[model samples]
Target chain A: MASSSQIDLSGTTYCVLTGASQGIGRAIAAQVSKMLGPNSVMLLLARNKEQLSQTASLCESKNVKVFYESIDLSKASLLEMNFALNKSLEGRRVTDFSTSLIFHNVGSLGNLAVDTARMQDVPELREYYDLNVFNVIALNTQFLKLFEEVEDRVVIVNITSLCAIKPMSGMAYYCSGKAAREMYFKVLAEEKKHIRVLNYSPGPVETSMIDYVLAETVNKNLRDVFNSFKNQGTLLKPEMTARKCVKVLLNSKFSPGEHVDYFDDE
Target chain B: MASSSQIDLSGTTYCVLTGASQGIGRAIAAQVSKMLGPNSVMLLLARNKEQLSQTASLCESKNVKVFYESIDLSKASLLEMNFALNKSLEGRRVTDFSTSLIFHNVGSLGNLAVDTARMQDVPELREYYDLNVFNVIALNTQFLKLFEEVEDRVVIVNITSLCAIKPMSGMAYYCSGKAAREMYFKVLAEEKKHIRVLNYSPGPVETSMIDYVLAETVNKNLRDVFNSFKNQGTLLKPEMTARKCVKVLLNSKFSPGEHVDYFDDE
Candidate 1:
């Protein structure tokens, strides 16, 4: 049997990716853009205009059309975000493509200074979850609505984490958001049988998120563990992990709504 | 070995129960109130003032002081709700009791009229999650903060559901909220080793929630299943399930953060 990584995605694709300015999302945008057949479209969304442009440039291909949108996913209302998404499409129909793909990669490891006992700030929690959970739900909902008549298949990927299943002591907001988002997609998968939904957990990648966790997390033990991952050279690079993620999509053997981790053998 | 249902909880207690106006919450409030020792404090919280008063009366005991607070958990900010909680406490210290307990039972099964694909209204989603997820987190945080110095063990019980672990079609909001809240409490359990955390999945109880699900859920298959349960008289009575819940707490042999379902063998 051919390995998942060796399997190539063949066809013109319409892909929507969030957090495309940085880290795994940018890498995925670049990698997948290279893989998509002629006349494919890539819509990259993030808050950083300059970085998003950089990502779009990296994804530059004569065959693949790239569009970058700079919008704070956390700040915008669902309607506003939907409008932005529609504007990005520029009158393109999802059914025109052979495949409809969406990568829900935008998330935040919230202020780790507060543990569960001290997480009493309601607005903060709301904002955090808006970015991490609610926005994902809204975008996914919009994606389904827009691509309901897709030709081949609709692939929805949530950038999930082991934290979605396992609780880390000081990371309540992050864990809960992941858990909620993961479950929402699971339900979505069950409700819409035709669409493919996967919770892809990109393991300990060397992202700015790791740096934020190291600097901000109140749990010293967890901080040290992350520090060790950094020092021990075990942290996976963003491009490498992103490659694996795309490979998983290409391989397409995993069960619908299944959580596929980077470490899990194909 | 003694069956879990046969075990009894002893000593004076400080108990905080939310959603105490009706259904499983009211039932649990009444049952647990009867078990508490002399001078135990029973603080019942819910939006329905008349119903909350009724629950308080049901939990009435000369030995146990029952206090009821009327607050819309979904509307109140964390600070406001904490103020309400403090006002209800009326200068009573949590440490005065031998056991400190909290039941996070308040949740909503959101507007099931819309499927996951149509969950586009951001404000509606926010309000739903405020009641089901965020308020629970705020209250649980306050409970931990208040009961941190209790003399004996502090027990935190989340009135969870099978939906927390299972994907229910057309019930995206409820399932996601439960999953998030369960994971939050699990993190709390891990962080605070001295406290007992239980995610009790009360099986298909005969509550207004069941009635709502039967009436409003968009998925006919799920609605049919609930209708079958109701028609076949297989739905669990609130009080009976409440008794089982108290027994589980009293027995307390399960691992910390374990999810105990009513259908599971003792």
Candidate 2:
């Protein structure tokens, strides 16, 4: 078996990352771009075209090629999504790349004001899962199909959370979405023995999401905890969390489909 | 705190059970109806009206009123569902009952032929979750809202499975759906201190679902294991598992939101 060190991005690699316009996704894109070889290709996906372009520019290098596409995964039909994804590939053969990496990072917090009992809107719930769970599964399937012939190395990362296994008072949708998405990847790991699947929980990071939670969460205790994390400067920076994520990828000591949290010791 | 022994159903009670037309659901309706006191009301919901009526008749008693509603949960709009649910209540005040109970037993196995990689159709995935997760949450929210004023005993039961926490190679949809539904209920338990929430895993049972798995499962290993369970007579009878479910409700020894399996020791 190939060692973890062999997964170095300095080789010819093909990387696809979602929600890459900002936060942890952007950080991962930038940091990984620096490590990728000259022939490597990186495709960034997000709904915000301007932000995606900015992220793409930041990730561009004299060595690696970076491209960004604005695609609203939540609203796109499966057929449309496949077309967009295929267009982004630009006819690149998956077998040509020595390494293939996909970061399933697109997700949402949904409506924090609604507790489990108040979240009765079926359409709203369906839209939330479309973005956070179904789309993730669909896109992962698409990429796995594209990379099926790549015999050497393929790694799929799910940006999971502590809520995937822990229930919060007012965050039912987010928690369930994370749990479902995480379990899907775990099932993939069991089905595909050759692929490496990791559910990386990045802890409480300093992102717009934290701000949103502080402003909207119905659970006073949960809101206070997020506030304290920020006030005490304990909340991690996206870049720092992104570094830890890449380290997990490069280290690769984790069991297949293991949930590796940012606070967990290496 | 009231003792678990005091939760005896020999009182004016309102019970709403989904998927009550057959299998464990039918068995539960039959058993619970027998225990309910005079003036108790039981509402059974399922798509098969004929089967539902059969189950309702089986559950009928001189003292209790049994009603069945045939509604396709997967296709019903939120407004339609609310109307159907309200119609089933027949102007009965939630406060009129001494006890309130809900058994969320409806679920599906989806297409066993599709593995994680093959479950790429977004529409199909959404439809699966609509029946298995979203509608469950919506209906639970509706009932909880109605029972919010019942200052006494109210029990919400989720018919979950081992697959909620365990990943199966080819059953990604079923596993993810169960995990998501279970998490939602867990969140509800955390939010609602007055209500009793229990996730009951019936274990491997002698149902048509088992036959479907044996016939359609893509994973040969999983099929063989299930077949062995059947041939060895290890698969539980629906009536026996229903007895265990009622026992759990009566014992109430489990922590709120705990997943209690049929195989678990009392």
In the order shown, the candidates' DockQ scores are 0.72, 0.76
Local distance difference test values of all predictions, in order? 0.84, 0.85
TM-score of chain A of 1: 0.94
List TM-scores of chain B, every candidate: 0.93, 0.95
TM-scores vs. true structure, each candidate: 0.94, 0.95
- What digit string (tens of lDDT, one per residue) describes model 1 on residues B1-266? 12122223467777889999999999999999889888788889899999999999998887788888888899877676678667767797766677778899998888889877778777787888888888888888777777667613677799999998898888888899899999998887777666678899999999888888878888987798899999999989999999999988877876668899998888
* Stretches > 4 Å off in candidate 2: A1-6, A87-89, B1-6, B79-90
> Interface RMSD (Å), each candidate?
1.1, 1.0
Please give, for residues B152-234, the per-residue lDDT of candidate 2 as tens digits: 46888999999999998788989999999999999888777567889999999999988889889988767888989989999
Task: Give the top-scoring candidate (TM-score).
Answer: 2
Clashes of each: 0, 0
Candidate 1 lDDT tens digits, A2-76: 112222346777889999999999999999999898888888999999999999999979888898888889977
How high is the lDDT of residue A7 in model 1? 29
Candidate 2 lDDT over residue span A1-266, tens digit each: 24333456777888899999999899888888887886888889999999999999988887777877788989866676677657766798877678888999998998898766778888888899999998888888777777777744788889999999999877898999999999998888877767888899999888899898989998876787888998999988899999999988888887778899999998
For residue A250, model 2's alpha carbon misses the true position, in angstroms, by 1.2
